[model samples]
Target: MKFSQWIGFTILAFCVYILWNIRQLLLLLFTAAIIANFLNHGVQLLQRIGMKRGSAVLSSILLSLIVLSGFFLIIIPPFAEQLPELFKLVSLGLDQLILTIKDFILRLDPELIKALPNSQQVVEQLEPLIQIIAGQGLSVFYTTLGIPLTLLLLFALTLMLLVNPSAYRQGFIRLFPSFYRKKIDHILTECDRSLQGKLTRILFKMVMITMLSFIGLSLLGMRLTLAQSMLAGILTFIPNIGPVLSLIPPVAIALLENPWKSLSVFVLYIIFYLVISIIESKFVAPLLIENRKSILPAVTLLAQVFFGISFGVLGFFLALPLALVAQVWLKEVLVKDILDQWKSNYNYSHQEFTSELKKK
Candidate 1:
């Protein structure tokens, strides 16, 4: 490579290195941007209804806080009360399971007992996990929910963005070449609209899942139906693995009640997951995005896995939206404009459009 090309490559590598180092912070900022984008819609609506910009922003923030406060009120208390019980029940369930195993083992031939899983050894392996849950389940649960300081920092950044989004937007657009700034701005707008549709669809899915889970749990006579159903709903915001996480609490409680019923609970949740997936893919999604081409399941799963590995939990939470942003830019800029426009650059007879025109 030429000396100048080498220099440019080194600078690009350094930039990527810096970005990698700050990836977590970038994810956090992106999260804040998403929140701000949604809030901005409310601010825009209020402004259209004759409120001043300042009043609209303030009202939007206040309204957001109210909704958040209500969400916490609904979630926190139920989880606080049920979590410990859930943990205790899970512990008892394990013990009961071990007892059943032991009894079966005692009835079996001594050689066969040795061949099968030893109840005592199984308990020894699971002992630490059971102890941790019994000892610090609530702390773990709350920590997973999030730390207050981190959440505060997140919202503060969101407010900053929400206050004057257009300024940040234009500043970002200015970073592109003058000739391409318009195109960049248009791409950003597309991303924003795509993101809004995704967020709305996600919210719709959450509500539907919550309702469906609640009724399913009730029909199955599951313990702590409300808390488990609510958990199912909230976790629906996450992509692939959320359903698995939501399955744990009910299954644990079911195990405590009856080992066989735990199997039933497991099967029931699998059904609910499938039902919700079908409902969203068939009904909710199309209404949310007009002419929305179906995204590949493998691609969505790949995004979840890639983001979860790269960005940890935050990436998993934002995976779909992040993927949405990438998809919009790639589709509009690369596939539609660059690739399609560049087709004329080739004089190959194998080109279908050119060949068809010649045939005509």
Candidate 2:
């Protein structure tokens, strides 16, 4: 490589290194941006109904808070009270399951019975896995502790963005050379549309999944029905893996009843999610999101794995929106502009568009 090319490469590497170090803050900012984008959508809707911008933003925020507060009020106390009982039930269920398995093994072969680990031995074997789960629980505890302060910062940032989003939009455009600014602005619009569409669809899925899960579990006479259903609903926001994770708790509880009951619970979850997935892929998504295609399941899972490794839990939470944003920029800047070598109006009319936007 030429000396200048080598120098540019080093600079790019340094920039990436710096970004890696500041990834947490970047994730936080991006999260705030995503929230701001959704709130901005609400603001736009309110504006169309003849509300002022400030009132619209305030109304949107307040409406969200009211809904969240209502759920917390209704659910938190019951969930907390039932949690210990749920754990006890799971432990009892697991013990009975182990005993049953041991008896089955004994019937098969006396020697196999002797080889099979008893409950205490099995617990010892699971020590590491239990410790890992405990550590994760602690991490969740710490995250919960910090949520208030984090939400404060997030809300503040979101409010600032909502107040004058066009300024940020224009400023970002200015970072590019004047020739590419229009194209970049167009790209930003595409990102906005994509984010909005994904967010809308995700919210709808959450509601539907939660409702379906609750109804199904209730019909099956599952304990902690509310908790399981709400958890399933919330986790549905995490694509591909969320439904599987949501299955664990109810299945464990069912094991307390009997193996057949456990199997029934497992089968119920499978059928419920299959129905949800079919309906979503066939009708809901196509009806709701008009512009962009849904993220491929492989792509969503890959993003989750990559981001989870890179940034931990926060990464998993923000993975889909992050993937959507990355996809937009990648498609527009890399594939279209660079690889495809698309012709640009910069050859003839760059100033015309910039001036018109500036006047607006």
Candidate 3:
């Protein structure tokens, strides 16, 4: 193709290379920005209640810390204690499940059962996989020790952003061409509004859903209902895969206690998830994102996975907003102005051709 196109492609590739090299830093910055955006809402509310900006920020930070600490206190120890045992139990459960499957298959289809790998062999193969996951889990635990440092950085950045949001907005807008800056500004404002509303609704709904899940699981006599419920609720933020992963722990716990009881709990979880998901899709999402277009669910999920893979847990958490930002940029800037221009010109030419034919 054209030399200009080649140059553009090269530039794009170079930029991507640079981004990949500095992905960790970019992830940290994005994480800070997301936290700042959420906390900015609290700072604004506190300001409305007659607090100064600094005081509001400080209060919001402290409150966040308290909530986080309380959550850790309630959830972490039991999780730490039970998680290892849960893994061991799950391995045993899988072995038993495989054996049951093999027995049933042998009765129904002897050839098929013979073709399958032995249950004991399968279990042996899984041992290495389990060890790798356990190692990763330990890594995660150690990584968590850096959380206070991360939070401090986030708080400092957030305070700066809240103290003078306009400055940051203007700085970002200036990165674009002068002709596009105004449009970019509008897009940023719209994104901020959309995210604020969506996140608030999500947080509130998650809390209610978690509470209901906890109560339901508790009623069903599931162990660690509170912890599992909290996990299930938090995972809901990740979209499609989250609920499934969340259900696994409780279902396994139920199975360990009693097979029939686990089956009941599993069925209950499926029903509950279906109902809640329907309600969320039909009512909650629409209400939260009223008048604000969002990226497709598939795109959102892909972005989360991509970011999560590249940058780990923090990346996963910030993926949605980052994807939203990318979507807004594509739609408002690239699609509307650049791509639509070609379509508009083509339509105009077609109209002219039709007029000439009519005259002829």
User: Best-fitting candidate, measured by lDDT?
Assistant: 2
Candidate 3 segments exceeding 4 Å error: 1-16, 100-148, 274-291, 343-360
Ranking of candidates on lDDT, top first: 2, 1, 3
| TM-score pick, better of 1 and 3 | 3
Over 4 Å off, model 1: 1-3, 87-148, 259-291, 336-360
Best-to-worst order by TM-score is 2, 3, 1
Write candidate 3's Cα lDDT for 183-300 as tens digits. Answer: 9888887778767766776676577668878888889877666667777788877766777777777766676667787788778877876777688777777665332675688988
lDDT of 1 at 238: 79
The TM-score of predicted model 2 comes to 0.78
Would you list the clashing residue pairs of candidate 1? none
* Range of the 10 consecutive residues with the lowest summed lDDT in candidate 3: 132-141
Kindly list the per-residue Cα lDDT of model 1 for residues 266-296, writing each as its tens digit. Answer: 8988887788779878887767643264356
- Candidate 2 overall Cα lDDT vs. reference? 0.80
Candidate with best TM-score: 2
Deviation in Å, model 3, residue 93 alpha carbon: 3.4
Give every collision pair in model 2: none
RMSD for each of the candidates: 7.5, 10.8, 5.5
Better of 2 and 3 by TM-score: 2
